[model samples]
Target: MELAIADKITQKPAIKRNVYENVTQQFNKASDLMDLDPDIRKILATTTNEIIVHFPAIMDNGRIEMFTGYRVQHNNVLGPYKGGLRYHPAVDIDEVRALATWMTWKCAIAGIPFGGAKGGIAFDPSKHSFGEMERITRRFTYALNGNIGPEYDIPAPDVNTNSQIMAWILDTYLSSVTPQERNRSIHIVTGKPIASGGSQGRDKATGQGTVFCIEQWAKDKNFDLNNATYMIQGFGNVGSWAAKLLKPFGSKLVAVEDHTGAISNPEGIDPDKLAIYVKERKGVHGYPAAEPVDHESFFKTKADIFIPAALENQITAETAPLLNVKLVAEGANGPTDIEGDGILQEKNIDLLPDILCNGGGVIVSYFEWLQNKRSESWELEEVDERLRKKVINAYKKVKNTSQEFNTDWRTGAYIVALSSIQEVYRTRGIFP
Candidate 1:
């Protein structure tokens, strides 16, 4: 459970707080600082609903295996539930809860008209065939049934999941619902394939969002993007995009790593070539052009910025002090634990909070939803322009809040998001 782990991160004074709980605690601390109402605070701290589903799927070996899945709707006060669906062995209810909660705040902070929800299946997708994965996803979709809809909850792809998974979800839903209902409800999911109404830029939204924020950070600090050195962890969609986008700005990408291994070139590795290589061969090991670096040494490299574009808890108390960078742009959700956060803050390191830093994907996904609902698509240039403005404005809001409250970026983001959510809740009022 991500939220449980985040909570654990804050429980023991000396022990490292769990990543998700640490994130929630940071929001709680900010709310307290803001003197937020107790009732509203409680509502924000807990999820509204959590659904766990147990379903049997026939494996590739003709054996029926039970798989557990979770879908947690953190809140819908702002709008419909919005979040990604991950397929991984480590997924659990608690993690979904935390991620969903984060989604609520992330959308609020980004000023998107959406709430927060997260769902995930508990199994390693790598071990499954494409057909098997599709079957599992369709079954999970069937279980969700009425719980997810175009106007209620929308799911995207996350960790070990992709557009194909979303395609299966859409197809399953479309087949289950009546034609009339389907026409009016196709916008339910945000990350479907292009043929299925997914937006053009959705693929690179997260990494692009990371770039927009980082570039804004650079400008505000009078730092040149071309002069910056980078060490990125995880070569997934987010990491790969960040690396590729930074090239034009003259970034000397010194290192990159995935689940398999890592590689480095102080002079900067060509992201395009590396990406193609990874696609063809899988993973970043033996890139041929760049020398292999021990996985641990990957993060230890001296650089201008360290981007943790991977999974949670990668930068904990144990690894926080080992970081040799000046800034940390969290490309993944809850990458830094509370202790690690404290270490970074004490060290005066600049951290682009995940809620704000990696929100571009969802923001664009919202655009995709709008396009789907209206049956309209925007040009890439238009989408890019709008995305830049939205991300930059959001960054400035968070930066201003940080200065106003004299707090770190994470708490500042929480303060802004909480105030917005509180106002919405107050205006909407409670139901009978």
Candidate 2:
């Protein structure tokens, strides 16, 4: 999950189309082009498990509220189900299913030992107090029961979720297990704080990975990053960090948008300063340094790169044409709709698809899990190096696959994911 990595920056989707349908269209296109194995295609099209739980939690107002939560396990043939659990109002069965399927593809393309799963509760976390949030998280974890485990389905933090929430989940899960199994189960969740068995670079892994892909793109296009202009949507973990990281490369951040509002400064906006403002104000709507702008103006801001690090379906047919960018580096899952993808392709805009771009989050999550499982900690530099190598390799694979198949990068990413799984199925065969 290339998560917003903070409070979810959600709004009415840019388009009214079904997200699952969009995802399926992408999947079918790749499957058909690659001549994917029929049986595996059938198996991959549907989810293995869909768990929806209604659990009651005590609110800060001393009243109990019934919260609906869902966990969809799409496929686990590669390894355990791994994905982020989010807290958002629009989390439904279809959305979770789509996200779970994307995780399957993301993990496969990245060559990670994990399948796909996505779980989330449908509610805004901001309306609740800290105690209410904790209670809700714990209750959600308990509601999940044994569906989640260190080796079965490891959960990570997504939108409106962070290390502290993961910590609460870790504790709640451990309390339910036997004392003998507790120590070994620390790998049950990733994105925890350093003291809680998380990896060194898990916090910024997604952003770092996105930047790595951008760097690869720059190298391929012979484009210099110095004095390049970029606009980011969502001033959360992925967007904020990408800005800061790109700033050192001499890229100027001219525009930013979030759930609160969009803001822009054509000359440049200091990511560090904007981040501090967001932390203080919880949004970019009123950042002192940048002037507020309407959504149209924000998207129309011309830049070399546009990182849609917010919600999915943001770049629909309606908004796609408004973009004045040479490249779209997705730092969020399903950010571009099918129409949007077609528009970008026609516009000759290069897209580093989400599966290939956001692999950093899960790759580092894998590292965190490994570190916890072995009770060994890796240094920050080592983690960064390994992440860079894996992201670049995946980028190359996707690029070559796109060229080989003569298709869009999105389709190429799906084909790469499907091909890897196809090989595994052929080697292992079906069970009786």
Candidate 3:
């Protein structure tokens, strides 16, 4: 279906390839391996809608600046479109499309009754003032007025975005609806502040879920979690919370690399202290307990586990060879590209694929949505217990699928997701 278009410009191959291509490659492998139904494959191959909005917002200095925002609805056959909205400089159509597609697979793997969608504004949140950020967030919400709804498309928090941003979006959306619908519409978004209907333990859900999968792996391998050493990339919510949650299991954080710098402390850098330091210094650069190290040194720091909680394509062919870990628990989406994936398989590095490993966030997001809709609020302990069960179940499913197909965990995850979609389409049949 390639259309005749304008002449294309040729350039050198990129070291860090396009994220969308990486995701598509992963999908193609699973589709081929399983002999996926052609009709369902076609439906899953493309997005339902791609919305790019350009709007103006008033800056703190009284100047109106234009911002480009995107929301790609990948699929909604299972239920509604559910994913996160991240505010990062790297936000673009291709990246959002990849993220949206991953969400589809993620939810399907987790057995959550939600499809996939993702959106974000392409700008640096750090450079913006509070007022400016609020105006930008609300403006994006207004621009997406009818396109998003509680039961239709629910947006959660992602990279550089948090409960506060979700709060702003919720308020803006509730105000736009009819007065009678305001109460019912509180479920329009997840990851809201607790007082605003956010689920308890939602803040650390992703990290909790990552640790749960790691625990499952440890049990399967007959390895103990007590006093295990690990390294992490990215000091944001997911990485920090994962480190903190692992503390109870006697897991130690040995080395960490963030955007600011990489630091290592063989004696173990305290997760709580590092978290506090990150909040004050805005990065992990000047932690007094750890020594600053180069990228190679950080990757080479011998440890039992490696968690890449940063951006996409981080563990490429070059970086993959340097990793010295038994397992990789991806707290972030698409952290490993196709080449790196091959390298890891060659090295026998057990991988907890992003879809199965980092599904806690969305699973908890589903909990939050259910709570809001049912007019219920769950306690922290209850939330934690429920998340543990859901994530472990998903972990078992992925492992079983991998074994059944004699394929990698990533492909196993994809097969699980594709099968779910295919079953639904087959049972219901396509619309006329």
How would you encode candidate 3's per-residue C-alpha lDDT over 242-303 as one tens digit per residue? Answer: 99988889988999999999999999999999999999999999899999999999999999
Clashes of each: 10, 0, 0
Greater lDDT among 1 and 3 belongs to: 3
Better candidate number, 2 or 3, judged by TM-score: 3
Q: For model 2, how does the per-residue alpha-carbon lDDT over 275-346 read when each residue is reduced to its tens digit?
A: 888899999987878888999999899999999999889999999999999999999978999889899999
| Range of the 10 consecutive residues with the lowest summed lDDT in candidate 2 | 3-12
lDDT of each: 0.86, 0.90, 0.90
Which parts of model 2 are misplaced by more than 4 Å?
1-17, 53-68, 87-91, 122-140, 286-293
Q: Compared to the true structure, candidate 3 yields what TM-score?
A: 0.89
User: What are the RMSDs of all candidates, in order?
Assistant: 3.5, 5.3, 3.3
Instruction: Rank the candidate models, highest lDDT first.
Output: 2, 3, 1
TM-score of each: 0.89, 0.88, 0.89
Those runs of model 3 whose alpha carbons end farther than 4 Å from true positions after fitting are: 1-17, 53-68, 87-92, 121-136, 159-161
- Model 1, 235-270: lDDT tens per residue? 888999998998899988899888879898898888
- TM-score order, best first, reads 3, 1, 2
Name the candidate, 1 or 2, with the larger TM-score value.
1
- Scored against the true structure, residue 148 in model 2 reaches a CA lDDT of 98
Candidate 2: pairs in clash: none
